[model samples]
Target: MTIVVVFIIVLIPAGMVFFFHHQNKLKLRARLMREAVRNHEFTFHLPVKGLFYGEKALQEALNDLGQDINKLVAQKEVESWQKLTRVLTHEIMNVSTPIQSISQAYLEHPKVVGTSLEKGVRAINDAAGNLVTFVDSYRKLTQLQEPVISTLRLKDFLEGIMELYHNITWEIGIPADTVLDTDGSLLRQVIVNIIKNAAEAGAKNIECTWRDSALRISNDGTPIPAEVRRDIFIPFYTTKSTGTGIGLALSRQIMTMLGGLLELSEKADAGYHATFILKFEQ
Candidate 1:
């Protein structure tokens, strides 16, 4: 009877210690989140492991809410870009259309035809036409069709991509059954752009995984220059002479439109140059 009494005393304190230790971790998450919010950071997430059922559920909800808020901010930013682009495009089209028309009219006039004026007018017409075409292409940034959300099995998606780009080696580390809810076509394009950018950066091996409900892609390539990191997602910004300057920008806008966020992660995996994260609002 004395042994039983002593055992209960020991077991109860040990259990209490474990319980309190676990509780501290949970409380730490809350404190971290509060600090993060106070600093205008909404992307913080905590692992839900070792939490009680109620705390786990609350943690999951908080994680989702943080991601959703981040997504909302990104979405609003892109929407503002779209509004500005729309206004600029409208004004550009208005001015360029008249310039093109007047140049064409001048070229057709007998006074200018078969003369130096004809050559100058033709150049003007061509330049104005090119401007119109350029603006028209940028309209895609604002005119994306509503995403037809579909469930894409991540395994199959990666398999198809590897087959298509068989020249480069791939290292995939994720559950085979992992899936994503997104527009398959749109998301595939964004992912393919990332792969292409990696290859362009001289990556011979690329790694992919899912973490914290975000698709994490890393590659063994030259690191991006620090000077241009912040401008990567800005429209009409690129380092390559022949680049359209909108690949990353368009990808980011697409993600925003699809209720997600695209970010270049600060932390890179070992043996990797950079990491890009595609985070879903969910």
Candidate 2:
């Protein structure tokens, strides 16, 4: 009877205290997480351990949620840019076409041929023609063909591009059996554009590296300055003397459409190489 009295007097109260302490700990953890999310502190990573299994599961779920949110944000941004480009190109073409047609007609009119204004009209006509070409290029930029995805051997693709520049020295690092899923024709255009740029830049050696679902094409030319690098992927931004400046921009857009990524990384070592990185989906 005395032992039973002790059990009710001591162990019962201790058990209640322990249960309340655990509940308080879990409540504190949940409150902290709510605060972090409200403050937009997405970098928060939960500890791997806790007093209960539910806490560990919550940590994993939070980690995955962060990753998913990041991907969704990136995808939305790309879609927004593409939509803007389409609208801009469409409106520009509509305005430029009429000007081009009118200028040409004025230049060819028999009565205007011998007038003092003839030379001025001819100049206007030439400018309008240039505008037409620029508009057409923008049209192409905004309306890229949907890629037909297929499995392709990387080495074979690189070899074909190399053949086009026989005089340019190139070292291909991809193995013969290395393969990836991509649209051969579209990807070929992207790679060709990069190689062409390298050749035009007077690069002596071009190195291609492939690993872990990424391909890096590096050229031993001039190292792009930090300021210029920021604008390289922007449409109509180019440092070249005579270039449309949309090649890299279009290529990046295409890669995004294919659920991949394309970017430029510079090497500032002795070689001063400019590298274009292409990342494919796993």
> What is the lDDT of every predicted structure here?
0.85, 0.77
Most accurate candidate by lDDT? 1
lDDT tens digits by residue: candidate 2, 1-282:
999999899998999999999789878877887886685434345566654577677778986575445345545655776787788877877887788788789878998888988899888778877877887787666678888989989988898889899888888888899988889988988888888888888888888888657798888876677777757777778998899987877777777777776767534223547888787778
lDDT (10s digit) by residue, model 1, range 1-282: 999999999999999999989878877887999998886567777888777899889989998798778777777778887898889899999999999999988888999999878878899999999999889978878888889988888878987887867878999898989988889888887889899998888989989998867889899888998778867877777889878776788899988877778988756888898999988755
Candidate 2 deviant stretches above 4 angstroms? 1-77, 266-272
Worst 10 residues of 2 by lDDT: 263-272
Best by TM-score: 1
**Model 1 residue 223 distance off true place after TM-score fit, in angstroms:** 1.2
